[model samples]
Target: MQPCDLTSTGGATIASRFYEPPGRPRAAVVIGGAMGVKQDYYAAFAQWLAAQGYLVASFDYRGMGDSRHGPLRELRADLFDWAADFDTVIAATLLRGGGAPLYLIGHSLGAQLPGLLTHRDRVAGMVSVAAGSGYWRDNAPQLKRMVLYFWHVLVPVATKLFGYFPGRRLRKVGDLPVGVVLQWRKWCLNPRYHVGAEGTPVREKFEGARFPLVALSITDDELMTERGTHVLVDCYANAPRRVERIAPADVHARRIGHFGFFREQFQTSLWQRTVLLLQGFQPSQETAA
Candidate 1:
C-alpha cells in the first residue's frame, strides 16, 4: 500500500492509501469507512483484495483521521460533504485502475451513504456491512437504553459546549464535527433516519439503485439489530438485493460484532465471503454462510 492524497470537489485534501497489484487488475474496490472510524482500520482487508488482483483505495472522510487538520470546532462539514469525499476517492480509483469493474465496500455509515454518491452509475456493485438505520428504538433491546442516552442526551450537550463531539475524551467514538454529529443525530431520531432527514431527493437517489447490492447483517451486532438492517436495505427500492445474516458460529467464532468484519482476524472466514460476492458468485441465501 502506498500513501496518497486526493483533492475533494470542494478542495479539502483527502488522505488515502492505495493497494495495487502489478498486473492488470480484475476490478477496483473503494472502501467507504464507517463513522468515527479511520481509513487505517481497513488497511489489512484492502491489501488482501489487492493480492487477489483488485486495485483498492481506502480513504478518510473530511474532519476525521488524516483529513482532519486544525481544530475540530472549525469544521463545517455535513454528511453530504463526506459523501462527496467518497465520490472523490471513487473517481481517483477508477482513473488509476483503467477499465476494471468498480466495487464499493461500505462499512457501517459507509454503507448508508453510497446511494447518494454522484458517480453511482460507474459502480458495478456494492457490499454493505452492518449498514442500518440509526433509529435508537430499532436498536437491539440490550442496547436501546444506551443508544437513546447517546443520541438524546450526550450528543447535544457535547456539541453545544465543546463545538464538536468530545469522542477522544469520552471514548464513545472518534471525535466528530458538530455538523456531522447533529445531522446524524437528527436522522437517527427520525424513524426513517437519513431518508427522513433529506426527504424526497435522497429517497429518489436510493430508488435509482439498479445494480446488485448485498447487505451483510451480523446476527450478534450490538450496534445494529435485524430491524435496523432491514430498514437500510428497504431503502434501495429498485436494486437487485440479497440479505444475509451471519452468526459468529458460522465463522467458527464466539463473536463477530459490528466492527469485527474488517479485523485482520477474519481474513480467512468472513473476508473470503466478501471476496466471493465481489467476484460475482452469488450464493443461495442459505449458502451465504
Candidate 2:
C-alpha cells in the first residue's frame, strides 16, 4: 500500500493508501470506512483485495487518523465534509486505474453517506457492510440501553464543554468535531434517520443513485438492528439492492460482531463471498456457510 494525500473538493486534506496488483487490475475498488475508524485499519483488507486483481484505495475521513492535522476542537468539519472526501478518493482511484469500473465497499457511516456522493452513476457496484440507519429507536437492545444517556446528556454536554467530542478520552466514538457530532445526533434521534432529519432534498439525492448493491448484515451486530438495516437500504430506493443476513454459526464462528467481517480470519469464508458478489455471480446456495 502506497501512502498518498488527496484534497477533498471542500479543500480538506484526506490521507489515503493505494493498493495495486502486479498485473492488470480487474477493476478499481474504494473502501469507505466506518465513523471513527482510520484508513490504516483497513490495510490488510485492501492489500488482499489488490492480490485478487482489484486495485484498491482506502482513506481516512477528516479528523481521523493521518488525515487529522490539528486539534479536533479547532476543526470545523461536518459529516458532509467526510462525504466530499469519499468522492475525492473515488475520483483518484478511477484516475489511478485509468477509468476502470469502480466498486465501492462502505462500512457503517461509510455506507450510509454514499448517496451524498456527486458521481454516483460512475460506480459499477457497491458492497454495504454493517450499514444501517442510526435512529436510536431502531437500534439493537444492547446499544439501546445507553441511547438515552448518550444522546440526551453525553453528546450535548461533551461537545459544548470542549468545542468537540472527547470520545477518545471517554473511550466512546473517538474524538469528533462539534459540527459532526451535533448533526449525527440529530439523525440518530430522528425516527427517519438522515432523510427525515435532513429533509427531501437529501432523500432525492439518494434516490437518484442507481447501482447494483449488496448489503451484508450480521445478526450479532450489537449496534445495528434488523429494522435499522431495512431503513438504511430503503434510502437507496432506485438501486437494485440485495440484503444478506448471516448468523455467526452459519459461518462456523462463535461471534462475527459489527467489525469482524473484515478480519483476516474470515478471508476465505466471508471475503470470497464479497468477491463473487462484486463479480456479479448468483450464488447457488445464496448464503450457505
Candidate 3:
C-alpha cells in the first residue's frame, strides 16, 4: 500500500492510500460512508481488491479523517466540497503514470458522487453499494420524517439565533464543520435536491455513458430498503446493470449494520460476492474461491 496527497480544484488537500498488486493493474476507486466515519473501516476491503490485482484508492473527504479542515471561521460539511474532492482524486489518478482501466465503487453517499460526474469517460464500470436513490423513501415512519423536517427548519433557525444549531452534538466533538452540517441539513430535508441515479430522470449528458454497473444491497440493510435499491437500479437505463441481494443469514452478525459489509469477515464473503458480480460470475463457493 502507498499513500498520497491530492488537492482538489478548489485547493482543498485530501489524504489517500493506494494499494496495488505486483502485476498489471486493474484500478478502482472506492467511495462510501459519511464524513464522520473513519477511513480505516474500509482498509480490509481495499486490501482485498488489491489482492485481486486491482489498484485501489480510498480517501477521506476534506474536513474529515487526516485531510485538511475548512478555514477555522467558515467550517461546515459541504457536499459540493466533497464532490469536488472526489473529482480531484479521479483526475490525479488518471493523470499520474498508470494504464489500468478505471472502475468506480461508492457506498451510500459515495455512490451518488460518481453518478454526478457526467464527464467520466474513462470509467470502465461502476458499483453502487447501498446507495440511496431518494432520501424521502429511505427515512421511513412518517413521524420520523416530520421530526427530521422540523429539525432541519429549527436547527438553522437556532443556529442563526444562538450562533449554533441547537442539539448539534457531534459524534466526534470538533470533528465537524458548521458549514458542512448546515449544507447536509438542507440537502437531507429537500427531497428534490438529493435525487441519485436510482430515481432521478437521467440528464442528456449521462445518456452516452455505457459502462457496466453493479448495485449491491443486503436484505436487512437498515438504511436502504429493497425498494430503494430497485429505484437505484432503474435509473441506469443505458448501462448493463445487475443487482445482488445478500441473504439474511449471510449478512447477519453482531454490529454488522450497513457499514459492516466492508469489514474483514464480510470482505471474504460479501465483498467477494460483489467482485464476482462485477466479474460476471455466479457468487458461490466454487466461483468465489
TM-score of each: 0.95, 0.96, 0.78
**Candidate 1 global CA lDDT score:** 0.87
Lowest lDDT block of 10, candidate 1: 280-289
Evaluate model 3: give its TM-score. Answer: 0.78
For all candidates, the clash counts are: 0, 0, 9
Off by over 4 Å in 2: 281-289
What does candidate 2's lDDT look like per residue over 57-106, in tens digits? Answer: 99999889999998989999898888899999999988987756788999
**Candidates in order: C-alpha RMSD to true structure:** 3.6, 3.6, 4.9
Give the distance in Å from residue 151's predicted Cα in candidate 3 to where it truly belongs.
4.1
Q: Rate the local accuracy (lDDT) of all candidates.
A: 0.87, 0.88, 0.62
Give candidate 2's whole-model lDDT.
Answer: 0.88
What shift in Å separates residue 250 of candidate 2 from its native position after superposition?
1.7
Candidate 3 lDDT tens digits, 151-252: 466555655764443342522223445566566565555543345322344343344557677877766565666666666565555767777776547656
lDDT (C-alpha) at residue 67 in model 2? 93
Backbone clash pairs for candidate 1 read none
lDDT for 9 (candidate 3) = 52
lDDT of 1 by residue, 1-289 (tens): 9888889967888998899976778788899999999998998899888887788999999989999988999988999999999999999998997767788999999989988999888888899999888888888777786877898789989889999999989988779999999889888888988888789999999889776889999999988988888888888888888889999999889888989998888989889889889878322221110
Ranking by lDDT: 2, 1, 3
All candidates in order of TM-score, best leading: 2, 1, 3
Highest-TM-score candidate: 2
